[model samples]
Structures are given as structure tokens and as C-alpha cells.
Target: MFRLLVMRGFALLLLAAPAAGAVEEALPNESAAHLSTLGRKPDWSELDKYQATITHDEFVQLFRQIYATRGCNPDLIKVELDVARILTAAETQNYFVLHFAKGEADRRPVPRWWAVPGALPNEARTAGPLAGFHIALDPGHLGGTWAQMEERWFRIGDAPPVEEGNMTLQVARLLKPRLQSLGAKVSLVREKAEPVTPYRPSDFEEIARQLLLRTGVKDARENFDGPADPEKEQTIAWQRELLFYRNSEIRRRASVINHRLQPDLVLCLHFNAEPWGDPHHP
Candidate 1:
């Protein structure tokens, strides 16, 4: 069924750079800093490579049609005449600006590590359409023991539980060889159901406490391992586990794909299902 589904290829841009003086205001103290569960500060200078690669119209189109629609608030991104200002840190004035190309003639050649189809040699083109392509297959989640925790496991009556992570891995395993057969270099983000992140839930405990405090949870405290308040302790534990499986794990996978593999294309496999209230029932 998945084989019959057509997957459209798209560019995934990761641009960053320090905000200009106009957008960079006084930052809050460390304790009052705002960040994602386990996210770090962005290095905006990375956007330098993408400078003048897209026209103002093109940038606005992609921003509105793609990025903005992806759960991003309109107020977070301001499209200007020559640049798009994106808010990097919420509750702060920190912003990242992406300068737009004047026009098609003014656009510079995009700096990219992957070889484009038009750039491939005649010999490679004759081999296959994907002859010089480097593709990475990313299985969606960590299955096995983490399937239930990630809520990707479901069962109907006495049927075996449907594990999305392992299933996606199986598809990737089957697809890798097929892509290689087309003369493409292929890499898997993960081969098994284990996590790629070295840090576990315990490692994120401190970070979780900080995140809770930012949310105005007054009970949050540092070096808090005692069970003085079980309810609050449970909330902290839950937050830690969520950060481990959701934030840390995906970030590690992205690092492997962007830095290690540097693939031209990435196929992230997953099964999208409607919310079924109880796993046992559906």
C-alpha cells in the first residue's frame, strides 16, 4: 500500500544566524530563559550559506504556504520587503533574518553538499535516475519497549499490538536495498528499535525541572529527588520521559542525518492513524 503512495520530494532548509542589533534585545537571566524542553540556543550564522538563494516573492510564498501553516503563529514570522524576520526565541526579541534575492538573475547558486541530478556525469545518469543520489531512510520512532510510551502502539481485541516504530523500520529495511539497486547511496537513520540519543530520562530531570519552572509551576526545584510530594514528583518524571523520547531522541536522529549522513534526500516513514481512544479497543 505504501509503495503505491507517491512521495513528493522537497528541500529541508536549516538556516541560522545571529539576530541583528534591531532584533536582539536584552535577554532574560539564565533562570528566566525560555527554550524548548531540551532545545539549545540557535546559531544564526548558519543562514549565511543560504543568503540570496531565494527571491523575496519565493521566500514569502514558501513561508506562507509551508512554514507558516505548520503550527507556526503568524506573529512569530514577519515577512519584510527584503528579508524575513523569524522569531527564534519566544518571549524574547531574538530574531533570525533571511535576506531575499533581488530577483531570479540576482539569486546565487545555492550552497549544498549533495549532488543535483543536473550536475551528475553522463555515466552516472545512464546507470539510473538516482545514480548519484544519497538517500537516508529514517524510521519514525523507537519501538519495542518504547512503543507504548511513545503511544505508537495499538491493539484491537486480542490482535497483536501494532507497533509503528518497528513497522516503519521494516519498511525502511525493505526500501534501502531497492533504492541502492537504482544506483543510489542509501543510509538508515536507525537499524533497530533502540533510541539514538545517549541521554535517557534521568539525564533530562534537571532540564525538566527548569522547563516546569518556566511554566510557573511553583513546586519545581533543583536537586529534588526526595518524594516529599509524590504528585509533583510524578509530573517531573513524566516531563523528563517526554523530553527524552520526544525532543532528545528526534534531535539525535536529525544530527545523524544532517552531520553524519548528509544525504540528498530523507524519507521519513510513519503510519498516520486517527485518534483511537483506547489501544485495546482500536
Candidate 2:
């Protein structure tokens, strides 16, 4: 009998969800090929050495470097790194200690289960929750970023993460790693570097103002909707060019997003408002 390992300060739950006849679905077969990138779990002795040699921060950092270096993944690395921060290394030590030594504990006392630390085999979720996964996503468009003014996303209404820049940063972060794990090669448009990226706050403001002026919405209300006032015409012309230009810049970054953070699907958000008042933000 393969005795199950119980966690410390954690209890692993299991259930054999059955079909209408109360019979379970056939277990999903886990092939080594599907998990080849994951490498192998540590032996208890290796865990001991890992415990003895690695500090909490060091443990996390080492794994981060491992993920980045081995081409394992970034997001999973980040999640694991977060897990390291969630509890002291001491907790990790205790958990593993109970795991290897106390196999005598009742083997989970439940139905079919997955071992923790080990994610559910890709095969397990392959059909049930994994089949035709639907995702709702957004991205940094028209040069949004965490540090810049909020007005851009405000007008659009479908806000991005904080700022367009940082949102892009995070989006790229999630996108590249996840797809790469599943055997993908992604190319991002705007990295955290110069040119083809969102502008700084001052620059974004100037750009926005320039764009607003070009729109002729700045023209007096008396000038509203005519055979097109010449000044307003100039504004409209500039607005069209500027909006397209800004969007081009965004797509330049998006082009990076397209290549590097490529997903099987893309969702873009466009919103229209009353064109009055400041938009909501936290």
C-alpha cells in the first residue's frame, strides 16, 4: 500500500467525484512527456540538504534563478517565490519532515488525490476544467502605465492594471512564462527598455494634451459640430494622427506582447464614456 503523506498545518483533501451512477471517471493518465519540463522532485536526503544549505530568501532566490535559467517558467517561479515568502523556511522544513518520516498517518482518508507541492498532473485537468479554457483578459493600450496619469484608461473605461506600462509588464510576465511552459516561443514588443514603450508621466501628459488639442473638442462649445471649423479641422486632423500614432506605439509594445507573450487568444478592451468627468481609480 502506498501510504499518503499528510501536510503540517495543512490537510490535503480528496474526493472521487462520480458520474450519475456513482462511478468515477477514468483517471487521467500522466505521461512523463507532459511533465518533462518539471524535472524531478527532491529525494528526502536532497530535501535535507536543501533545508540545511538554503536560507528562506536564498531558497526563493535560487529557485527564481533556476526557473529563469532552466527555462522552466517565470510565473510559476514567481508563485513559488511567493510561497517561500508566505511562510518561513522553518515551516517548509517541518512540512517536509512530517511528509517523509510519518508515512504511518492514515493515507489522506479520502478519495483519489494529488500529492501537494506537485501540481495536479496536467492530465488531471486536461479534460474536465482544462478543455477549451475560456479566459477574460486586458492589456496596456495607447501607452498606459502605473506611474502615468489615469485619464487615458479613464476615458476608455476598461482600465488596465494600475498603469499601462506596469500592466504590460505584468501581462508580459504572466503571458511569456505560461505559454513557454506549454512549449511556446514568445516575442514581446516593448521590453522594460528604451523606445517603443510607454512614455514617462510628463511625456504622457504632453502627449495626451497634444492629442486632446488635436481633437478640437478643446474648441468652444459654440464651435460644436459644424461644416468643421478650420481651427477645429486642424484639431481633428491632429487628433486623428495623434490617436493613431499613440496606438501605433501601443501596438509596437503589443507587437512585443504578440511575439514574446503570445497566447492562443487575444482580447482587447475598448471603452467609450460620456466624454465628461474624471474616471474612477483607486
Provide the overall lDDT of each model, using Cα atoms, as 2-decimal numbers: 0.69, 0.34
TM-score quality measure for candidate 2: 0.26
How well does candidate 1 score on lDDT at residue 198?
81
lDDT (tens digit, per residue) of candidate 2 on 1-282: 001111111111111111112222222122122121111222233223222222345444544453233333221222332233212122243323312112224223322112332444566554444323322234444343323222333335465333444555566667765755544334444455234533332333333344455444464222224323455434433333333335334434434433343333444533431233454542
TM-score of each: 0.73, 0.26
Residue-level lDDT of model 1, residues 1-282, one tens digit each, is 111110000113551112222322222223334343344454557666778899999876765576443434455667788987766665788777888999999999877666666788888767777898999999998899988767678777787888999899999999999998888999999989999888678877677777777777867544434334455444777677777788778867766776667787889999952238775786
**Highest TM-score: which candidate?**
1
RMSD of 2: 21.6
TM-score of 1: 0.73
Error of 1 at 34 (Å): 4.1
Cα misplacement distance, residue 215 of candidate 2 (Å)? 9.5
Model 2: how far residue 74 lies from native, Å? 53
